[model samples]
Structure formats: C-alpha cells, structure tokens
Target: MQINQLTRAYRYDGIDLPIPPHLAGDPQALRAYHATLYPAILNAEAIDVGVAGTVHVTEYRRAVGTKG
Candidate 1:
C-alpha cells in the first residue's frame, strides 16, 4: 500500500498518538505538535517501523546515554 494511503501513528511514552488528517504527510509538523504535548519529544528521534497491517508506525526514541 502507498504511504499516503496507509495509517499513521506516533508511539511515545508507551502511548500511541494517531496522526490527524491535517498532519498526515507532514513529519515535522506532527513532531512539533506532539512536542507541545510531550516535551521529551524535542530530544527524541523518529524511528520508522516497517508497515504493520497497512499502518505506518514511527517510534520516538529518547537519548539514554550520558551526554558528552
């Protein structure tokens, strides 16, 4: 299935933030909006997970090691 046709969601803090229609194809916009709700997202990176049942899942991973 095409990416635009597949469902979109963001996984963070063990919760799934389903991407709304307005922010569907805009990764940066989605991140910005999600960051407002979860400040930790600012430091996190988006990790794309292969399609699952036609849904595109992206996980937000935060830095765990000591910052140098």
Candidate 2:
C-alpha cells in the first residue's frame, strides 16, 4: 500500500483506499489502513513490525508516546 502524504490516503494496485479525514498525518490511521491491506500485501518486499491490525489511535499514542 502506498500513502499520499499530502492527502493522507492510501492506494493498493492503483485502487484508492478510503481513510477518514481526521486521520490525516496521523500514524494510527496508517496502521489501520495497513491491517485492512495486509492479506493482499503480505508478500510485499518490506512491511514494518507492530503494524498488524486496526488498533485505535489513542492506544497507539499511549503505547508509543513519551510522558515527559
């Protein structure tokens, strides 16, 4: 899946993937989009770990953010 940073949207095989407007520039949105496309991109050359499913944005912020 390829994401157009400017639009904060994704596309697979030239087909555009629908993502919410609020999620623009947010990593969590990226993760959710990734999960939905996993089955198709499983054989892709490179996919990062920890991006396996449609996890909520808040959870991601808590898990990855620094309290300081």
Candidate 3:
C-alpha cells in the first residue's frame, strides 16, 4: 500500500505562509484572502507541483524586491 501527500504554501517576503484551512481547496479564494494581507500576492507566481515524488507540493512565490 502507498499513500501520497499534498501540500500548499505561499512564499512572500522571504516567509512561508500556510493556507487557511477554509480556503485551501479554492485557489482563487486563497489568492483573494492572501492578497488582502499582502497586496504583492496579487502578482504572485503560482506554481503547481509536477509529477516527481510521493509528496506533491504547490507553491505561490511572491517576488519581493529589496531596496539596495
């Protein structure tokens, strides 16, 4: 017997944010909620997990620029 796990997270401002349980199933809704907290997420990169290993991962990467 084998089992697979699915994980989703948001990377914003160099931090990993966990998705709210209520919005975990709905990507669009999750985005809306997250956008409210971090407006930059509105332009975040949504990456879906490709088939490779047992644990599947979905990541939302928000490109935050640094002041130099």
Candidate 4:
C-alpha cells in the first residue's frame, strides 16, 4: 500500500501511485493490474482518506498555456 511518487517531465500536479513491476509499461494493463491490487491495498488500509470519510483525491491541471 505504499504509494510512490513518480517522476514527471514537467511541473504538474497529480497523484503518483507506483505501478507494480507486473504492470510495467502498458497503460491498459496497468488499469487491470490496479483493479486487482486496489482491493487488497484498500483492505490493508493503505489508501489515504479525507476527514469526512472520502478517499483522498488529487487533481492535475495545465497552467495557462503550459502543457501538462
């Protein structure tokens, strides 16, 4: 349940959960991989949460004319 921050090419804001080695390189595969792992991670209480019982969420946005 340890979420690791990933390196980005430019300044942007987002949540970076480390993709397990088994899910490397493929975005579609990663989604499936997470589908399997997330339940376990949540069961283990590895997910962050908000004060009112919501899962902690993050947002990513591009600056005025900057690519994100």
Candidate 5:
C-alpha cells in the first residue's frame, strides 16, 4: 500500500499564481502580494483588515480614476 499527499496554494489575486505555504503565511510576503493585487494600497494612508480577513483601504487618494 502507498499513501500520497498533495497541497496547493493559490494567490488571492484572480490570476491564480501558485504560492508556497511558507510565503503565504509570512506577513511581509502577504503584504507584497497585497500590493500586487491593489497597487493603490502602496500609497494608502491606512489599511484595515476585517474579521473575515477582508482588506479595506481606510484612506487613499487618486490622481485620476482608481483601480482595484
């Protein structure tokens, strides 16, 4: 008899980039991923994470239109 285990991680971004478990759990790595998803957050004055793990930009300004 043989046993095998497989685990997969996908970045929160819709692009489906594979993420290793270690990087996913790292706070700094998580922030980089977040910046990739919402570039505006790079300049955001404040950020809030909800109980459900949702990220909210509490304060930000846009030169023109906004994205993300």
Candidate 6:
C-alpha cells in the first residue's frame, strides 16, 4: 500500500496499520517497524505499550484522541 492511499484510508476509516510481530515486544522494535511501515502508512506510528497494565480504549480516548 502507498502512503497517500494509506492516509486516505485512515482518514476515512480511522484504522492505523499494525506493526509487525517481530517488533511487537520492544521499544526499539516499534521504531524499527516504523522505519519500514510508516511509508506504507503515511507516518502513522504506534506509541509505546504499557508493560504493567492493560489498555482500555475508553480511558485512552478520554486522555488522547481516537487515533490510537
């Protein structure tokens, strides 16, 4: 997928593309994944995951935007 296309898709559907599995459990892994995946997703990136707790979308949205 091209970057522009991905951005348009995101704008319409609010879906961020995922990071690959090999990069899922590490901080640098997400950065590495971003290096590869961002071009395909127009610079969309994943934030660091919480290691000590579960993520709640409701709480997240109240704190941040819907893009997570």
lDDT of 6: 0.35
**Looking at candidate 2, what is the lDDT of residue 61?**
16
Query: For model 1, how does the per-residue alpha-carbon lDDT over 1-68 read when each residue is reduced to its tens digit?
Result: 65457777789978998677888788899999899989999999899877888687899999789878
lDDT of 6 by residue, 1-68 (tens): 63321111011124344546665557455544544634432243443333323331110011234764
> Best to worst by TM-score, what's the order?
1, 3, 2, 5, 6, 4
For model 1, state the Cα shift of residue 44 in Å. Answer: 0.3
Model 5: lDDT equals 0.44
> Candidate 3: which stretches are off by over 4 Å?
49-55, 62-68
Displacement of residue 56 (Cα, Å) in model 3 is 3.7
Query: Predictions ranked by lDDT, top down?
Result: 1, 3, 5, 2, 4, 6
For this target, which candidate reaches the highest TM-score against the unseen true structure?
A: 1
lDDT of 4: 0.38
Q: Indicate which candidate wins on lDDT.
A: 1
Every model's TM-score: 0.81, 0.34, 0.60, 0.29, 0.32, 0.30
Taking the tens digit of each residue's C-alpha lDDT, what string does model 5 give over 1-68? 96544333333322334455667557456546656767854554433322232322222333455667
lDDT of 4 by residue, 1-68 (tens): 87655431211133355556655656456544444634332222222232332333322232345445
The clash count of every prediction, one per candidate, is: 0, 0, 0, 0, 0, 0
| Candidate 3 TM-score, true structure as reference | 0.60
Instruction: Name the TM-score of candidate 5.
Output: 0.32
Model 2, CA-based lDDT: 0.43
Error of 3 at 62 (Å): 4.7
Which lDDT value does model 5 have at 28? 57
All-Cα superposition RMSD per candidate: 2.9, 13.8, 4.4, 14.0, 10.1, 14.1
